[model samples]
Target chain A: MIISEMAFFLLVTGALILTVLAPVVLIGLFIKDYFSKSIW
Target chain B: MTEFALDTQTALFIIVGFALAWIAFGVWLGRKNKSHEDFALAGRNVGYAFAAATAMATWVTSNTTLVAPQLTYQLGVWGMVGYSFAALGLLLFAPMAKRIKQILPQGYTSGDFIRLRYGRFAWAVFLVISVVYAFGWLVSLGMAGGILLEALSGLDYYIGMTIILAMCVGYTLFGGLRAVIATDFIQALIIILGVAVVAYWLIDNVGLTSIHTELSHAHPQLLDLLFPAAVMFLFNNIFFGLGEIFHSNVWWSRALSFRKNVAYKAYLTGGLLWLPIPIVTGFIALAAPQLGIFPASADMIGPAVASSVLGKTGAILVFIVVFSALASSLDSLLAASSDLVTQDIYHKLIKKNASDQQLMRFNRYCILSLGVMTWLLCLPRVATLGALLNFAGAFVASTIWPIVIGLYWRRLQGIFAGIAMAAGTIVGLVAYFWIGFYVAALVSCAVSGLICAIGVVFNKSQFSWHQLQENEQ
Candidate 1:
C-alpha cells in the first residue's frame, strides 16, 4: 500500500516537471523558427 | 453551491478581451494568403516548430483538460494512465504521416487519400465516418467550453457556448490554417503553463502524500493497481485514441501542410510532449476529496477542484487553460472539416473546374456553416463529454485497419475495405448499445481488422502508390 502511494507521488512529480519543460522547449524552438523564417 | 470564483462581469470581460485579440491576430495572419493552397494547407511549407506545436496543441483538446480528470475520478489511477496512452496515437502516426506526405504531397485532406487510394464507394463510406467523428468532436468541444465557463464562473451555458464557437469560427475563417497554427503556438504555451502552475500549487499546498493517503482510506479503488474495470479501460481507451488520430482529417491536413522532412519528427515530439499532460491534469481530481469539493458531474471536477482550492486566481487560471485548449482544437476541426467539404464535396463532386480563388471563398463559407451547425447542437447541452466522444469510437475505430492496410498493403480492394468499415461500424454500435462504452473501440477495431485480413488474403488486385499522385492538380 505504501509502495503504491509512493509510486503515485513519483509519477505526479515527473509529470509536473515535464509539463513545465514542454512550453519552454516549444517557445525556444518557436524563437529559432521565427528568426529563420521557418514559421510559415 | 453555485458560487463563482470570479464575478460574472470580470469573467465576461476576460472572455471578450481574449476573443477579440485572437480574432485580430487571425486577421493579421490572413494577410499572407494569396492562393487556395495557402488558405487550406499553409502553402504546404510549415516549419518544424509550428508543425510540432500545432500537432501537440490541437491534440490537447478539452478531452485532455476535462475528460482526463473525469475518467480519473471514476476509473481511478488506471484511468489517468489509460488516458495518457492517447499519445501513442500521435507517436505511431509519425511514420504514417511521413508516408502520407510522400504519397500525396498535394493532398488537401484525408478524404482525398481515401478517394484516390480506394474508389468512390469506399470514399463515400469514409466520408460518413469522417463527418460523424468531426461533428462529434466539434460539438463536444463547444459543449466543453460552455461547461467549463459555467463550472468556474456561473456563466450561462448558452452564452458561453455561443461565444466560443463564434470566436473560433471568426479566427479560422479569417486566417485559415495559418491563423489556426499561429494561435495554436501561443495557445499551447498558455495551456501548458496554466496546467503546470495549478498542479504545482496543488502539490505545494495540499501535498501528494495527503492526497494519496486520503484516497487509500476513502477511495481505495482509485489507487488499486489491480482494479479490473480500469484494466479493461486501458486498452479500450488506447484503441479509441488510435482510431481518432488515424482517420481524422485534422491530423492528415497537418501532415499534408508541414514541410517535407518535418512531419515525422514533429509528430514524434508532439506525442512525447503530450504524453504527461493527462497525468498532470488528472492528478488534480485525486485531490478533490481532500479539498472537500464534490462536483455535480465528473467532467466539472477539474475546474471545481482548482477553483475551490486556489480561489479566484486558480479559477482565472483554469478558465484560460481550458479556454485555450478548447479553441486550439475547435479551430483545427473547423479548418480541417471545412477542407474536407470544400475539397472533397465541392471541388471534386460539384464543380471540378472551380478556380483557386473560388475554392478558397467556398472553404470560408463551409467554416461559417459548420460553426453555426455546431452551435445549434451545443445549445441543448446533450451528453457528457466522455459519453459523446466514446460514441464516436464505434465509428472511427472501424477505419483503423482499413486505413493502415490501405496505406501499406496493395491486396485490399476498395469493395472489401468499404464493406469492412460499414459492417464494423454497425457491429460496434450494436456492442456499444448492448455491452458498454469501454468495449466500443476494441470491438470495432477487431471486427474491422478481421475483415481487412480476409480482403488481403483473397483480393488479387495490386494498388500502385503512383495512383495517389496522379489525380492531384
Candidate 2:
C-alpha cells in the first residue's frame, strides 16, 4: 500500500515538473523566433 | 446559489479587462492583412513558435482544464492519464500535417482535402462531421467559460458565456488567423503557468503524501492501477482526440498556415508540451476530498479545488487560465470553421468565381454567424461539458480511418469513404446508447477502419497523388 502511494506521488510530481518546464521552453523558443523575425 | 470563491465584481472587472485587451490586440494585428490568404491562413507563413504555441494552446482547452479533472474524479487515475493520451492526436497529426503541406500546398481547409481526395460525396459527409464537432466544441468552450467564472466567482452563467463568446468572436473577426495565433501564443503561456502554479501550490500546501494517503483511504479506486472503467476509457479518449484533430479544419488550417518545414515539428512540439497538462490539472482533483471541497458538479472540481486551497489568488488564477483556454480554442475554431465555410461552401460551391476580397468578407460574416449560432445553443446549458464532448466522439471518430487512408493510400474510393463515415457514425451512435460513451469512439474508429480496408481491397481505379494539388482547379 505504501509502495503504491509512493508511486502515485512520484508520478504526480514528475508530471508537475514537466508541466512547469514546458512554458519556459516554449517562451524561450518564442523569443528566438521573435528575434529572427519568424513569427509572422 | 452556491457560494463563490471570489466576489462577482472582481470577476466582472477581470473579464471585461481581458476582453478589451484581447480585442484591441487582435485589431492591431489585423493591420497587416492584404488578402483572403492573409486573413484565413495568416499569409501561410506562420513561424515555428506561433504554430507550435497555437497547436498546444488550442488543444489545452476547457476539456483539458475542466473535464479532465471531472473524469479523474469519476474514473480515477487512469482517467487523467487517459485524458493526457489526447496528445497522441497532435503527435500523430505531425506526419499528416507534413503530408497536408506536401500534397495540397494551397489547401485552405480539411474540407478541401476531402473534396479533392475523395470528391463531393465524401466532402459533404466530412463537412457534416466537421461542423457538428466544431459547434459541439465551440458551445462546450463557451459554456465552460461561464461555468468556470460562476464556479470561482459569483458570476451569472449567461453573462459569463456571452462575454467569452463575444470576446473571441470580436478578436477573430478583427485579426482572423493571425490574431488567433498571436493571442494563442500568449494564452498558451498563461494557461501553462497558471496550471503549473495551482498544481505547485496544491503540492506544497497539501503535500503529495497526504493527498495519496487520503485518496487511498477515501477514494481507493482513483489509485487502482488496473481500474477497469478507466482502462476502457483510455483508448476511447485517444481515438476521440485523434478524430477531432484529424478531421477538423482547426488543426488542418494550422497545418496549412504554417511555413512548409515547420508543420511537422510544430505539431510534435505541441503534442509533447501538451502531454503532461492533463496530469497536472487532474491531479488537483484528487486533492478535492482531502481539502474537504465537494463541488456540486464534478466538472467544477478543478476550479473548486484550486480556489478553495489557495483562496482569492487561486480563484483569479483559475479564472484567467480557464478563460485563456476557452478563448484559445474558441478563436481557432471560429477562424477554421469559417474558413471551411468560405472556401468549401461559398467559393467552391456557391460562387466559384468570387474574388479574394469577397471571400474575405464572406469569411468574417461566417464567423459572426457561427458565434451567434453557438451562443443560442449555449444559452440553456443543457448538459455537462464532459457528456456533450463525449457524445461528439461518435460523430468525429468515424472520420479517422477515411482521413488516414485517403491521405497515404491511393485505392480508397469516394463512395466507400462516404459510406464508411456515415455507417460508422450510425453504428457508433447506436453503441453510445447501447453500450457506453467510452466505447463510442473505439467502435466508430474500428468500424470505419474495417470499411476503409474493404474499400482498399476491392478498389480498381488508382488515384493519382497530383489530384490533391491545387493545379487541378
Highest-scoring model, DockQ: 1
Computed on C-alphas against the true complex, the DockQ of each candidate is 0.69, 0.65
Q: Compared with the true structure, what per-residue lDDT tens digits does model 1 show for residues B1-473?
A: 47888788878998899999999999999999999999999999999898999999999999999999999899888889999999999999999999999888888999998898889999999999999999999999999999988887788889989998999999999999999999999999999999999999999999998898899899898988778878778998899999999999999999999998999999999999999999999999989888898888889999988898899999999999999999999999999999999999999999999999999999999999999999998888779999999999999999999899988888899998899899889988998999888888989999999999999999887999888887885
lDDT of 2 at B164: 90
Give the docking tier of candidate 2: medium
Give the alpha carbon lDDT tens digit for every residue of B302-392 in model 2: 9999888899999999999998999999999999999999999999889999999999999999999999999999999889999899989
For each candidate in turn, the interface RMSD (Å) is 1.7, 2.1
RMSD of each: 1.1, 1.2
lDDT of each: 0.92, 0.92
> Which regions in candidate 1 have their CA more than 4 angstroms from the true location?
A1-3
